[model samples]
Target chain A: MKIAFTAKGTDWDSQMDPRFGRTEYILVYDDEKETFESFDNRDIENEAHGAGPKTSQKLFELGAQVLITGNGPGGNAATVLQKAGVKSFIGAGGMNVKEAYKAYKNNELKEF
Target chain B: MKEIVIISGKGGTGKTSYTASISVLAGKDAIVADCDVDAADMHLLMKPVVEKSENFYSGVVAEIDPDKCTNCGICTEKCRFNAIPVINDQHIISSLNCEGCGYCEKVCPVEAIQMNEMNVGDWYISNTKVDNTMVHARLGIGAENSGKLVAKVKNEAKQLAEETNKHYIIVDGSPGIGCPVVSSLSGANYVVLVTEPSVSGLHDLKRVYELVDKFNLKAGCIINKSDINPEVTNEILDFLKKESIEHIVSLPYNENFTKAMTNGQTIVEYDQGELRDAIVQSWEKVKELVEE
Candidate 1:
């Protein structure tokens, strides 16, 4: 299963972004491939409205089974993701992307 | 020709009703622009007849072609928005989650992804009961770019005013200090700020005043339902005095305002009473100040 993290940087040591929609980058950890991929996500800021929905759409397209981030998605986006059976793990507030992934793997993150 | 915006810092502060009355008082020579695209209601009272309309497109969303015979899920893997979800072993694009960023189109190996334009809203040009044209818009639910829509409404109103040689552009501006409100303030010559005497009303008034002051637009205040609390009314008066804003008029609490709204009429149209006189008096003041 693929997992996603809203990250501040492109590297494994980067801190988790506090915002779901306005994150600098979306970092994906492919547990199956043991690989790290970073997608630049600052373009969402250019949108005048529905940034949350757009970001949620991006994650859905990424095939992210789980989202590990500091902040929760907005109401509409949360509803869409929840309906799609994509689980969220949010206690990665100050943790780096790698640490957030570890927390998910060790069952240390809080489920929304 | 002058452009005066009617605004309120909070909802239900009589902004729309007063703007309707002002439009009537301004008559056929005024071209009106309902800049509150998010929740436009001025057209309701004016009973506008649409003469022209155009669809507003704001963004794009990506779609997937499932017949490519490759359920490799690579498109889903690269999408930044959680737009694609797999169910029943079939992948689909959830438009709500799609940001239209086009990342999926680039990463798809099967050439199955296509970008489609998003229709965000519609804007209208209509002739109102007042014999002048009104520009208004309705934004689609979950649509982005409302500020741009407001700008579009204003631009259309301005062009209409120039084309018809009208003397005023009466704008019913949106109720906050956000992007829509900012767009309304761009070329405004003056502002008729509507407010109440309640504590929350006063709080919002000050915040809105800061924005008006920053833009340096000439402004006047109208205190609706001023009799609800005398102390707060005095506090509002003091605040207005400190800000050097004209106290255009203070209207007493009356059910007639609500009656006009329920009956789909302006207070000036519903009754030829003291309320109508007060509005007429302030409108003359608005003319004086705009000219000054």
Candidate 2:
């Protein structure tokens, strides 16, 4: 399964983003391939409405089955993720991408 | 026909009361459009008898058929609004959360999802007790498209005015510089901003004026309850003069306004004193400015 993390940067040491829709970057982790890919999300800042749904669409197209972020998406975006059949875990705001991944493995993150 | 919109950036600044009196003063020559769909109160004073009523449809919402039998959860995964939620292992659509985007209907594989038109509100054309036409609307509970509803009321009022050969359409606009307010200002020939001599009132007036300025529309100012705060009132007068906004009138704080409301009579009908004369003069000035 692929996991996505909202992050401040492109690397594993980048701090996790707390916001879902306006996150700076969406970093994807492929468990089977052991590879990481990052998608820039800064362009969503200009969206006046449906920022959540826009970001969720990006996450859905990224083929990420699991989302590990700080605070989860808002109602609209959350609906998108719920429909996309993607599982989301929040409360990873203060942690870096690597720490958030470890916490996800340890079941320390809260299911959103 | 000319359209004149009366708006108060802050609530309880006498927009409705002022509008009621203006309707009475303008009489048969004007038709009133109450665009405050959030909490329509002009009906209380107008006492409109419904002449015609129509259902207002706006946007669309997705509905899921549980009998289709696939718990595959595709609808929930694709819905951007998160309107569909799993309840008792069955996907149910929440009408309130739905934005009527129809994306889920397109993505649903079993064709279980159907998009349905949402009836968000109702608009009415009525004959007021004062014997003039009044166009108003009532938004359904949890409805968010108040701007569309306001536009409906304005368009209907304008059509009614044109049919009846009325010279003006007087609009009672909603508070704040939001969507509904913008809709009210659209195509209006003139704007009458009712304000009080208070800090927040002045602040909101500036914000609302910024919005009006964007539409490049002419505006006049009515300083209601000017005596409540002389210093702030003077400051407001200075701002009006600097902006070249016409000073329509300055009404003092009076309990007669409350009395007139309680009696279900407009200030023009209840008060035959100087207060009534000022309101009548204000209406005349508004008519003259709108005509110009």
Give all TM-scores, in the order shown. 0.70, 0.71
DockQ metric for all predictions: 0.05, 0.01
Give the least accurate 10-residue stretch of model 2 chain A, judged by summed lDDT: A43-52
The digit string of per-residue lDDT tens for model 2 on A1-112 reads 8999999799999978666766779999999999999999987643434667888999999999999986566556889999999999977866899999999999998887
lDDT of 1: 0.83
| Residue B193 accuracy (lDDT) in model 1 | 92
Name the candidate that leads on lDDT: 2
True contacts kept of each: 0.11, 0.00
Q: Candidate 2 docking: what grade?
A: incorrect
Q: Give the interface-residue alpha carbon RMSD of model 2.
A: 15.7
What TM-score is obtained for chain B in each of the predicted models? Answer: 0.93, 0.95
lDDT, candidate 1, B1-292, per-residue tens: 6888998989988989888998999989799999877678888899999999999877788887879727788877887787888978988899989988898888887788898878888989999987878998887888753555666787689778878899899999987877667667656778899999999999999998887775556799999999999999999999999999999999999899999988988899997889899989989989889888
